[model samples]
Every structure is written in C-alpha cells, then in structure tokens.
Target: MSSNEEEKLLSYNGEVLIFQLSQGDLAKEGTAKTCRLRVRRMTFNRSTSTFIQKSTGIFSMHGEYSGFEMICCSCAADFRTGINLPCVVIRRNKKKSVFKYFLLLLHSSNEFEQRMNFTLDYEMKDDIKILNGPSILWRHNRTSFYISSQNDTIVSAPVEFSSIKWAGEVENLGTILFGVGEPHSTNRESSERSSKSDYAVWGTEFYAYSVESQKILSGSYFLPHAYGSVVTCIHICATKVVNTVLRISLIALTQKNQLIWFQDGIPKNLCQLPFQDPCALQVMASDGGDLLYIVSFRSSDVCAIWKKNFQVASKWQKVKSVLVDDFVGTGTEQLLLDFKDTFNTDCLTSFKITDLVDVNYSNDAFDPMENDLFEHNLQENYSLTVQALERRLQIGLTNIQELQKHLLLKERVLSKSCKALVGLVQGKAYIPPYEEKDILVSLCGEKKQLPHSLKEKSSDTYHDSEHVIEKMWYRVLEDHLVVGVEIKNSFLSFLNDVTLSLLMDQVCTSNPPIIQCKNSVIKLDKVSFPATLSSPCETESVAKRIKLTLHNKERKNSFHDQSSDANCIQVFTVVTALSPLLAFHNFCCIVMLHARWGENSGRFGETCTVPCGKLSLSIEDISSGKYSVTLPEKNKPLKEPMEDLCTLLAVFHKFCFQITSPDCTLTSVKIWLLRHMECETVKEFPDSFLCKSLGALNGTLFSWKQKSPFEGILTVY
Candidate 1:
C-alpha cells in the first residue's frame, strides 16, 4: 500500500486544541462543554464582535467593533453593523511633524451618541515642539466635541484606528477655560485681584507623540517633576479656552502620592493622596466628562481614579476598587487592571479573564527526526523506562548465548581423539609426521623397534659432522622428510639478467628477445660474449673476460669498473631481471621473495610468478604497515592486486631479485617474452620482462638483450 494510505489507516480519532483558564476565570461554550475545542468555522461579525459570554452568565463587550466572531454562533454578522450603532463620533484634524501626524478622537457607543475630540499643533524639528493646543483637536477637518453618557467605559488598543478616539476624551467636554487654565477676568478690578486667588493659578498641559517612537511629538503644557512618575498616558480635551487656543489639561501623579497639573509650563493645580505609601499606577483616556482614568495598586487592592475638569483639576476622585487573592497568579488579571498604562486605553467592561490560550510550542512545523526529538527523549531518564526494560532483556539473552558457548567448548574437549605413528630411516628411530607434512598418512610406512643388542656407538664419536648427517638421514622417514624446500623472499626476486639470458637462449636463438618498450624495438646481434653468473661472488670470471676483450686496446684506452659499487636501485633492476626460475616448479609449491627500499624501510614489492606461467605483482607503500594486491589467474591461477601499483612504487622507490640457469645455443629456437608491469611512480622501469631458462645442466649459452642502453632497461647480473 502507498504511504499516505498507510498513515490514514494508522491515525486515531479525537484530536483537540486545548486552552488553559487562569486565576478564577472560566470558559464555557454556548453548550457548556469545556475540556477541548476545535475550529470548525471562523468569522468576523458585529453581534459577536467583542461580545464574550461568561460561565457566570454575564455578558461584556470590550469594544463595539473589535472581536473575533465565534465559529458556530449562527449570530455571526457583518462587522459594518458597528458603524451605525448609537455611538458618538469625535473627529480631529492632524498636525504633521517630521515623522508622523498627531490627531485625537473619542466616542461612546452603548448609550446616546457621545463624542470628544482634540487638535494638536506641532512643528517638524529635531525634537518635537508644540505650537498651541491639543484642546481643540480636529479630525477629517472637524473640531473635537463629545456626547456624554453615564454607564459606558471608553477604551481601544493602539493598533486599531480607534485609539485616536480614545485620545480625545475630556472629563467635562463642554467647559472652556481662559488664559490656558484659569478663567480670564472681564473686569479690570477682577484681573488685578485674581493674582491672589488659588483657582487663578490653574493651568492645562498637553502631550502628543507617535507610540512607536516613544518621543513627545508635542506638549503644549509642561509636566512638572517628571522624575518619579513617567507619563504613562495622555488624554487631550476638545473644547477651546477663551484665548481661542485649545484648553489642554495634564494630570500627573508620582509613585509617592503627589499629583500636579500644568498648561504650557505654568503650574495650575496640585493634590496629594490621603495615604503616604507609593503605588503602581496606570492611566487610560476615556470619553465625556471623565477625560483620563488611573488604576493604582496598593497592597492587594487595585483602585481607579478619574479626573473631570476640562482644563486643570484641583483634585482627583476614586471611581472603582477591587481586591485580588493570589498576587502572582493575578498578574494576567492585573494586565486588565493596568491596560491603560501600556496601551493608553481601558477595558470598557471589567473582565474576569475567562480563558487563556495554550502556550504554543514554538516549532510546530519542524520535523521530529531532523530535530533529534528521539535523542532528546532518550536523554530524559524519566521517559526511558520502557526502553531500559528492552535493553535489559537483550543483555540477558546475550548472557545465555555465552553460557551455551562455554558448554559447547567443554563437550568438544571431551570428544577430541588421540592418534600417533612411528617410523625408522636407515635403522634410526624416526617420527612419521613432520612439520609441513600431510597430517593424514597410511600406517604401511610405520616401522617396529629394533632389538637393543644390534648396536651401541660412543656418544662422543656420534658428535662428528658425518655422524650428525647420518643420524638426520636415518631418523627422518622419506614421508616425513621435505627435500630442498626454499622460501625465496617473494616471487619477483627471481627475475634477473643471468637467468633471463640463459632461459631466452633455451627457448629461442634466431632472433633477439621480443621486448615491448614504448612501442619501439631494438635488436642485438653478433655480440662478443661474456659469461656472467648471478652470484655476487662470481666477479672473478667477469673481470678476466673484460680484460681479455680489451687486451689489444689496453695501451691506448682507459678502463672502468662497473661492479665496484651497486645501489639499491641497481639491485632492484638486477632482481627484477629473472622471471623463469619459478616457471616449472610444482603447481602449488611457489616461492615468495621480500626486499625493501633504499634505506631498509618497511616498503617492499611482491610478485608471485607461479610454475604455470601466471605472474601476480603487488607493490606496497608500507608506512601503514600492511600490503595487499590481487593477481588475476586465467590460463593458470592468480588474483589481481588488492591495491593500485602506483601507490606501492611511490614509497619503495627501488629494490632487487636473483635466479640461476644453464647454457644454451643461439642458432635454432625462437623465443617470445611478454611482461606485464604497469606502475605509476616518480621512478619507473617502464618495460615488460620476458625470458626463458634452458638446458638440462650445461652446454651453449645465448644472451637476450636490448641494444639501446639509455632507455629504461638496466641489465645487471
């Protein structure tokens, strides 16, 4: 079956996407089942947008236009439905800066249409500078204004376009102040007397900036003592003051319970909390008279504060308070409490944090094998219990097998047999079986012991060499004695000129040896003959012959001794010259020759030239201390070299061999020699060797040679 079909057959049912609930928050479907959920269908619609139904049967909407539509509610409708709802619309015109435009809009949707707006003017400069007011803000070229409501909470996420609406709310939208924050005096007497009134010191301040830059695009009014309490949030008012510039109000509270208000750097108002302890505070802008809201946490209780003056407020009032049980566990619920600080918006309705989505594993699409999941799992000791059990079972099985092997060894020793034999050679005692002798032999060769009275020789007299030889001959039976079994270094050492020339004469006389060299040929004829022997000790005869040939030219010519010094290179040439000594030996009793390079290094070459005309050659680079080659056998039997010849010769640059033969005539037989030696090395003897060994013992000798002395062939005996 195909792989896909196999997978389909193997997969089980009931997969799920699980979500976790936090704190006391609970999630329930319309049907009340809660363990797992799957996305059957999803939509974006109005009735379901931001509308969450809790397990406690309470319904809340965070924003009228922002929420995901449920998959199966059947109430899923177009998101456009929110545009026509009874919501207030506040619009403001944007003032352009170097990086961005700042505008403010605010509205309430649940009750009658309530709206608020703010207009901010700022210059394009290195650092943003405000020119006038955020009080009379405008959007779509409309000046900011608002409709009031009692029950609705106004909020928005900064990412949504409606965050502009949240920025424009004013606590008292209809009110306008004169001279920034304090009302301007119409009577001359009042203007002069106003300097003494505490209310006359009031002022408004505006802060504007793009959220991403974390920069103040503009602040029409100053924030005093900005050290401890950062500007966590800002709310711009829509109504203009008597001076025609927008009335901007700022509400800033320190962590130490001190609060201040300013208009264009002029201090207008100040207040202090009833308690001296510090608190964590968050701010969110809202609609209608409640312009800005603050959430503060003191110990285990969270408190909310709202400021209502259109310009500057002399005091702040508490709007809500709630208590929490577990401090750390309620961090998420605290997020809802502190939403205004981070986003400059508030959760319009208080939420119980119904559910939290699962903490997704990061590598959902990664391949498990590629990621080494199996290896990681194996590293976990707690997860390997089953695998550990299987490993123990395997070890137990191996122990049983070892026990069986021990029992088998005992049985084999008990059943082994004992066998023996005896013999005599020329009246001397002998052992029937000798080293290298065939283990299986007939009892017919066994001899009985002789009577003791037949002889007695003195032990001192028996110590003589002749007696030793006699004893050896008689003590070893013919079946047990191996005669003339020599271990030549390796087969290649037998190829030398002294043997090759003798063998060539035995096989051929009419022509020169047919040597193949670079597809060229050279012939030798009528050459003055010098008898040469392969034994290094035979220079006695070679010197005499050279002297004889040059007797007539002695007075006028010079002489050079060619045999005075021979290097390892010359020795290798000398050895590789003999190939026929091993030609006619027994089919199985072959010789092996071993020789090293110039410095006696371990590197050496081996060639097995068998009795039946088959030659297998191997050259090795022995730094790694191992050699192997295959020699192919066809007409006879051989395996080819196990390694390439090139690597062999590269190390053991030079080497030698030797062989012996009898005399032959050059007048009758014709001989052909075919050599196969292909090796790639810096130093190469790029020529094949072909020669024959002739004559029963001695008679006439003919030499096979190449006429060109400078090519590759080096003839040495």
Candidate 2:
C-alpha cells in the first residue's frame, strides 16, 4: 500500500465495520473465515473549468471506487469461535495506541445454560502496542484477579459479600452494586400449586461498594409494583452519580431464585419519576456528568423528556419537561428530534442543549436556611474580633497608667535633689557635722540669743573703790548694730551721775564723725542697794552716803550730767541703731564714758575731778570686747594747749587733763599759767616790772617767779 493510502485509511473519521464470516459463507466464497475489521475511503473529483457558460448544459461527474482495506484483523484462538459482546478500554496515556479489551463469552449446554454460562476475560497485550502496568478485575464470587505487565496472575482470597445477589459493576462509580433477595415463604403447598409467573419477585435490599472504605453501603429504596417481575436489561453510563439526578439500572435475583429489576441500586417505586411507566428510559447526561435527561415514552407516537437540573445542595430539580416524536439525535451544538406518526406523517425540530435543560434556574432555588446560617457565623466572628480589640485596648491603658505613676515618682525625686543642690550653692543651709556624743549634749551651751534691742549694758559693783566694764559686746547683723555694755563698780564715794556715748568716725577724710549718746544721770538722792549685800556703812548711812540714780538726758544736755564718781558708779545701757557700716566702707566706733563724784563732807569736803574714758572698737573686736588702747603719757605737753583745752571743754564739762612743761623758756607755758589763773599778764601787768621779769626769765627761777607773782607775792613778812 502507498503511504498516502495508508495514512488515509488510518485517519478515517467514519465508523469501521467488523464482519464475522460463518462456515457456510466461507465455504461458498472459498476464502478464510477470519473475523476482521475494515475501512472504506471515498473520494470525489471536482470540475476545474472557470469559464461561465451562457447556455444551459448538463454537468456530469464520475466517482472512483476505493476498495475496503484491512486495518485491525485477528485470527487468534480467543477469536477462533468468534467474539461475543466486546468493550474497548481506551488507555489513559494519549500518546500510546495500546488498549485493554474485555470480552464476555457464553458457553452454554442445555442444563448449564439455565444457570451460570457467562465467562468474562480481558486482553491487554497485542502485536500493535504493549501495556505498561497491571489490570485488576474483581468478580461477584469475591475473587480479585490482577494481571501484571508480564502477564502474571495475582489472585487474592475471597472477600465476604454484603448482599446475597450480586448485580454488576457500577462503571461510573468504580464500585459494584449488589442486592439482597427477599425471604423465602414456608408454605410448600401454595408454592407447588402456583404457576411459574407466581415465583417472580423483586429484590428488597440493595447496596453499593465504597471504594474508599472498601465496604458496601446501602443504596436501597422502595419499589412501586411487581407486574414485570424480572429485570430484562440494565444500562448505566460510565459517569459517576454525584447528584440525585443521574440514574442507573441493574438486574438481580430474589430470595426464591427469581429475577428482578433495580434502578440506581434501589426499588423503582421510591424514586421520583417524571412519568409513571416509562416505555423507553433514556438517560442523557451532561458533559460534566452533573445533569440527567430522562426521556420517557408517552404514547405510541409521542414522547416526553424530563430534564433534571443539579444544584449546589446535592439535590436535583425537574426543571423542564417537553413532548416530541420518538426521535432523538445529538449534534455538536444542537439536538435533532424528528417526529413521525403511525400514518407516516413527519415533523422535525432542533433544540440547543442549554434550552432543553433550563440552565438558568430561579433565584428562589438557593436555600434560605443556609444563607441565614452563614450570616450568623459571620456576625459571631465579627463580635469576637471586636472583643479581642477591646481587651487589648484595656491592657494598653493599664500599662500607660502604670508608666505615668512611675514618671511622677521620678519627677518628685528630681525636684528634691534640685532643691538640695540650690541650698548648698547659696550657703543659707547648714548641716552640723556628725559627732560621737549625744546630739542633744553638743547643741547645749551659750547659744546666740536674739537681741531685742540694738545694744544693752549692765553693771555690778564688787568693792567700794574698783570699777570695771564687765561685758561690752556688739553685733553687726544685716542692717542693724547692737551694742551691749556692762560695768562693775567698787568705789567708796557716792556717784552723782554716769554718761555713755558712742562715737563713730567716718573712714573718709571729708565726712565728719557721728556721736550717739545715752545718759543715766543721778537726779534723785535715794539709792537702793541689793538686799544680799551688806554695805560698808550701816543701811541708814548707805542711803545718805551714796545716792546714785538714773535719768534719760536730752542730746543738748548730754555734757551737763558729768558729776558721777567715775570709779564707783556703774551704768548699763543698750544702744540700737541702724548701722553706718552699710554706707561706709570703713568706720570707727568709740565708746565714751563719764563718771562724776559728790563731795565727801567728813573729810574736808573735797570734790574729786570727773573721770572720763573712751574705747575704740574694731569690727572684729566688737563681738568679743577684748581690744584695748593705751592712754597717752600725762607728762607730754600739747603743742597747742590753749586750743586743745578749749576743744576738750566744749565736748565734755569735766575731762582728764595733763600738764607737761612749766619752764619759762616755753613762752606758751607762761601764757597758759596766766590763762589758768585768769590773769592776763601781758595786758593787766602791762609796763609793770613783774610782767617783764616773768617774761624775760627763762630758767627754773623764772618758772618759780612766774608762779609766785601769780600767788600775788603772798607771804610778804
């Protein structure tokens, strides 16, 4: 054969016919009676003329004959007696032309034919192509056969059957559907008299094998009637039944050994049928095998078809029903139905599969209960999410509050530390050093008592002659100065009065000095002595002998009360005033005191000179009163005695005086002597001999003469 002819034969799209030559036909044709399959290719020639003929003409074309060619022909022992019903199992591998073919053969004898006469076998290896793996077959007798790639047999033990009557394999489900026959009756008399028709019955129980569990599960349902008791045939598509819409039929034996029919492994009565008794039950499934079309024979000339629509709920709905003639044909895109009557009247119609099946169902078909359940679950999830967020928020707030409290405590500690640091820098705060002794004992002693006044003085007398300033102290604090003076007196004479004064000299040469005074003058003669001390004289004489008292003196009369006995009387005074230290960089403080004595009447009634003294105070020495200044020598004469005496008399009514030289060589001395005696020798004794003699004399005789002349040359004799 040419390559083109071989290719055309192999690629033929039309059906190839298989013929079995009988012994008589083979003898008559004088040929080998081999069963074989053949293909006949047809071809036509087209006219190539392009010219248009204006005149009408008859066109004729001849067809060439393409004789039948042998494609798949076999003469093996299995096909020697001719094959029975055969099924082709296409291999899943598209690249291979190998296939598994199963053949059911019946070897019948008169007696065994009424019983089990069928033998089923399959062939996987051929001269054309080889199968790579094993093929498995499980039979109704509980035996499993495995044919390996080497064609070796692997036989397993018998498995127990869940039902007594084995129907057949449900090819779509890859499981065997079985049935249980009804129980036998015990009445032998009724059974013996009954006709053969009375023995026919239907199976009561059914089951289908579960591939996953390797067990049989129930698939039984009730039946309607038993008029046609035995099942004549069964047709099931190799499509798995997922929804209730698809259908399958099988034949089984009853308990009495009678045959019966089962649809979908269940009794026909329990199934929801579209029509009562379907003369022709045609089940057309969708490409996806989810929908089923059950076409029933309605009348002799009319047919009705019901389409079962599958839903998401795993339930089916009879969505469409239509009537047409008993003619059905399927094309790629349309279904052709040719209706013909008994009288030969014919009509044709075509429908799209989508239209016949009612592909678009109403919205009401969705289960409302399921939607409500879904919403409920969604709400529950949302609530849980909200609650979780709230819990997290609460925890966050708690942590924040704790952090705030911690921050506040830290701030307080920082503030206290800052205050302590400030105190140390300013020097206003003091902390005592730690000591071994009790703190209370160390704090005791002479404390600095607050001074109510600026200055205070107190005096005490120990003996009748001695006088001493016991305590004299001052403090300069802030803007005020406080001076304290205490005096001790022990003189034997009466004290007429006492005067205390503070003299401040400005350090600047241009400013004048300031003097502040407080006087305690004796204005009364009543003197009060302490009861604890015994006077040197009797109590009655004490009052008469010493009449010391106190009185404030005006500033103008500050020098008028200098009559106290300086050695006997004591004065205590406090002076408080605003300090001059704030305004002056340096200043001098002099404490001046004056004491006067009364005359002693019993001893010639001589009155003593008034006593006065001054104390200079330094800023450092004021607190302790331990400084002293020496008095100038009394024998030293003043450079200008007359001027010095006049200034001294102006400040104090009674002040200490010291005369140095009485020699006549110092002319000022002669002049001072004349002035002391209130004798103006130059003027009163002018041109007199005494004045000249005194003025001219410069030796010791001159000093004596000067004094004698002042005495008025007293002792004449």
Candidate 3:
C-alpha cells in the first residue's frame, strides 16, 4: 500500500474501537434513551487483521475468527455468542443515530479516546478536521497547517512546492528545501521525469516565503555545489526569537554523505568528520538559537556532533564524538545515549549539547627563537651606534685640547715679549746695538734728528759709542733724566767752576724737575771743578767724569690755557757751562732747546722762529768734536779794548762734544740775550748748514748777541 493509504487504515481502526465503547457508555447512562438504536456485529480476522468502515453502510472484516466479540451501543447488548459475523449493517432510525454515526467516524483518535473514557466533561462546539495521513508533499496543495493563538484554531494554506522534500520556517519566512538533479545523473529515468527541466541540475535548492503574506519572498534556485555532486539532506535551524533578520544555519548532507554548512545557501566546508554510513541526521538550536548543534548517526553506533555560533557564522567546530555500542537519540537541547559497559550492563546518559561545544577556539602560537633573534639584533645595533658616538666624542675632545694648548703657548710668548718691551722703555735693560739702532734710527726718525755720521759708521763705532756714552751720554730713564759729563783739562783750565741749568717751557713744566744730587738745582751755578782734573804742572789734558740724575715730579700747577691758540708753540731749554768765566760774557755756554708746538706735539715738521740776534763765529773741524770759535786767528796781546772781548770770551768759548742719544734733538732754540747792545745785521743760515753743523755738535750754544739797545727774547731753529 502507499504510505498515505496505510496511514488512513491505521486511523480508521483506532476510531472504530473508540466509537463502540463511547456509545455503549452513553446508553447505560440513559443519555440516549429517547433515540432509537441499531446494533451491528463485526468479526475480526487475526490472519488478515483488516477492518473497513463505509459511510452509513455496513462494517466488514476479512477472515473470520472463532472468538470474535462485538458490542451494540443502543441497548448495551453484547453479541459475543457464536455468530458468523462477516459483516454488519445498522440504519439510522432517528436523526440522533445519524448524529451518533457522524460522531463515531468524525472524531479524531485523541478526541474519540477522550469521549470513550469519559475524561472530557465539556463538549466541543465545533468539529476539528483530522489529519488522517502524513502531510501531502505535493505542489500547490493546501496541506500546511498553522495554529492561531487568538482563537486556538487550526489554519491551513496551500503552499507551492516542486520536488521539495523538507519545509520549515526561519524568522519570518518559510524555507523550502529540494534536490536539484546532477548535471549528468546516473539515473536517467529520474532526470527524464522532471517536469521542470531547468531545475534538473545536481545541486541544492532553497526558497523563502512570507508566512503572513502567503507569498514567495525569494526565488527557488539551485544552490551551487561541488562539481559532480548533489545534496541529499538539508536542515535549517534558526534562533527562537527572531531579531532584525533571522540568523539561520543550513546543514546539508550531500549525496556523498559528506556534511557541509551553508550560509545563505552557499556551501562552506567548516567541519571534518569521519565518513560512515549515515543513518540519520538531526539539527537543533540552544541559547535562543544563537548556537546550533548538529548530530549524525552512523551504522556502527558512531555519532558526531558539530556546533556553530550564529553570531560568528564563520565555520563549525566538532563538538563531540561517541562510540555508543547502542542506539542514541538526540533531542533539541539534550542528547540521550545507550551503551553497554564493561560488564555488559546497559547504561543511559544524557548531556546538554551546549556543554559539549567550545565557543572560543584560536590557533595563535609564535616561535620564541624568532623573538630572541630580533631582540639580539636590535641590541647589537644600539651598542654599535653608542660605540661610534663615543669614539667621535673622544676625537673631538682631543682636538679641543690641542687647540687650547696652542693658544696657551702663544699667550706665554706674548707675555715675555711684553715684559722685555717694558724694561727697554724704563731703561732697566740695555737694548742690543742692532735692536737699539732699529728703535733709535728707524722709529726715532719720525720726530727727532739723527746723526749723519752715525748712519755711516761701522759696527766698531757702535761699540765705541757704547763705551764713550758712559762718560757723556744722557738719557731719559722712566721719569728721571740721567746726565753723564766728562771734563777735560782744557775746560778746567779755562774756568774755575761750571754751572749747568735745565729749563722747560710752560708745557714741559707739567713735569717738574726733582734734582737727584744734593748740590744740583733747576739752575746749577758755579759748580766746583771735578776732583780728577789735571794738576797745574801737567801739560797733558786729563778727563774728569760726573753723572747726575734729574727726577721728574708731578706738576703742582697746570699751564694749559684754553683761550690761547691751539697752535701756539712751546720751547724747552737745557744749558751747560763751557766756561764759567765765559758764561759771564754770554758767549761761552751751550744751550740745548727743543720747541714743542703744533696741533700734535709729537709732529716736528712745523716750527716757529722769532727774530733775535746776529753773531758771527767761525766753525772748524776738531778731532775731539766739531768746535766753533769767535776769536780771530792772530794771537793778539790782551788789551783793555778786549774787555768786551773778555766778556764775550767769558760768555762763549770753543768746545767739542758728541751727542750719543737722539733724545736730545732740538728743532728750535730759545735764548735770553742782552737788550742794551747796539744793533747789527744778522746773517741768514741755510737749513742744510744748520742741520749739518749744529746738528753734529753734542753741546748746544746759548749766547747774548746785540740786536737792539734793549733786552729781548730770541728764538732760533
């Protein structure tokens, strides 16, 4: 028989038994006393065990049995006595019988049983249509059932399906599953029978429908599958309370019995399991369907369970495996396994599917060696950099030290040179002849007169000058003036005593003279003769030497006049006695004077001259020094008219000396001459003659010449 026919037969037998008992009880209670009742007897055949009920007709069974018993409902009469009851017929005597018959066949198995057992105290107002067979899986059949919670009524709707094997709902939409034939099916007969040729491909098909609208929401299409493969079984599981959109997991069993997972009908190989002859496949959800569990049973009692989280949707993880040794059944939330222990004793265990799965799984592992090597290389590089910097720093420090040392050495040499220069300026150290020549000749040439013959003299003369200067040279040492004088017999015999005078101009008086000798004054007069002078009997001339120092004191008063012309000239004088007797005649003294007057006193090119006197003297060359004489060459006897000559003779005389130091150069000479003398014509002298002749003389000459019958100042250059 077909599967649907078998289901109907089973349902009919169950309802008939319930009908007889329920009616008999009702008659015993007198609830159907007013209604006419009819009895029917039916016999059962144990060999065939078949029964059939026709609408308002007769009851029949095949293959009679000896112990057959039948009951009548109207009067509670029993027909158990030997009767050849192959069939029985009962007609409805009243409308109640028709209603009774209707209730007998129309009641579902569960309702029938309840009525017969008197368990239902309340009557049902409406009749419920029963499903006599498994739901019909056909196209365009109104076979699907839903329950309305508002009125608790069963709703039926016609749903479209083509070659669909399973149907379910995920979230709001119902999902339909079907098999699409392989590209080249080995079973050609099945392929040719397909009414829809386009869907005859070897893959899985999924379709979605809106349950509320009773309309298809998504198309019926084949899910892409592996080459040369087809899907055999598919189970879709979703969360219980749908939110936003439903989260569903599709577990598909292919023709090869290889289980795979599908997201949106796309295949994903997520789990690995040992292949076996699969007998059944089951899927369920837990934790409000956020987690899914799948179990597959093999012929050898082998079971494998897989778990997946709907939230992640990446892959499935193998949760558990068991060799049951007996059968086991997996429920929605739990698993029941039957097994034989070591003693062959049967044991049953239940487990929660969620507890079998691990939710967090990761494969994160690293090699320790790699980390160590990287750190070592980094440390080495850092050390190398530090070492390089240290080396460069050391080199820089060495260079700096060398530079500092060089600077210090240069400073030391400079300090020593400075000390030597200071000593030369203070006359504490004697400068070498060549170095002295460099200073006196080259440097002093800027403002002072240099001796012409000294420039022509040899190195021998430089030594001779050094020794000769010990007796007659004069120098400025620091703030003191040193004078060395040599007296010869000619000077001593000509005068009993000598006087030396030093005079400075108004500007030069800023440095007042401090006499170093007890007997010396600013103007020394009638100085005693030198002790080493020659005795009167001696015909040869002997020399006597004396040295004197003139210290300069700070000026007590100032002579700088601001109202005067800045170019006004100042002259300084120094006087020495050639003969005291001749000095009285104003013709026998040497006067050394220097004029200092200019915008800059150190500049000697500009000089001022004042007209004063005229005196004629004959200049002649002498071996001792250059000498000048005013007396005529003839040796005349002393006459009273020569008194004036004596006066002149006493004032001036022929003397010779040489200047050793250029510190005594005189650009202009000043003299105090007699103002009461008769006027005379003065002869002009050339600069060349004066610079040559007068410049060669060591001692200066200061004399009184008659210019007018009155006394006046005289200046000469």
lDDT of each: 0.25, 0.30, 0.29
Q: Which is superior by lDDT, 2 or 3?
A: 2
Candidate with the greatest lDDT versus the true structure: 2
Give residue 118's error in model 1 in angstroms: 29
> Which digits, one per residue and each the tens of the lDDT, describe model 2 over residues 130-202?
1112123333343333332234444332333323233234534433433333323425576567543343322
**Residues 1-717 of candidate 3: C-alpha lDDT, one tens digit per residue:** 121111011112212221221112224544342211222222222222222233322222221111112222211111233221112112222332121111122222222111111111222222122211111111323134433222334344443333343454344444332333223233457646643322333322334444456664332222343211234556654433344544455666554445666554445543433554443455434334434434454443434444542222222222223211101122223222223234332111111112233211111133324434544676778977988899999999999999999988766544444344333223365344453333232211232222233234432323323322213323221112323233222222222222333322122223322222211211111111111112323222121121221210111122122222222211111223221111011221111212232333344343221111111111111111123222222233212221212222233333433213112211111111111121121212110011112233312223222121111123221
In model 1, the runs with Cα more than 4 Å from the true position are 1-207, 210-216, 220-222, 225-244, 263-265, 274-295, 302-717
Candidate 2 residues lying further than 4 Å off, grouped into runs, are: 1-31, 39-173, 178-280, 285-304, 308-717
- Quote each prediction's TM-score: 0.18, 0.21, 0.23
Which scores greater on lDDT, model 1 or model 2? 2
List the candidate 3 regions with Cα displacement exceeding 4 Å: 1-165, 174-205, 209-211, 217-222, 225-229, 239-248, 277-279, 283-292, 298-302, 308-334, 339-717
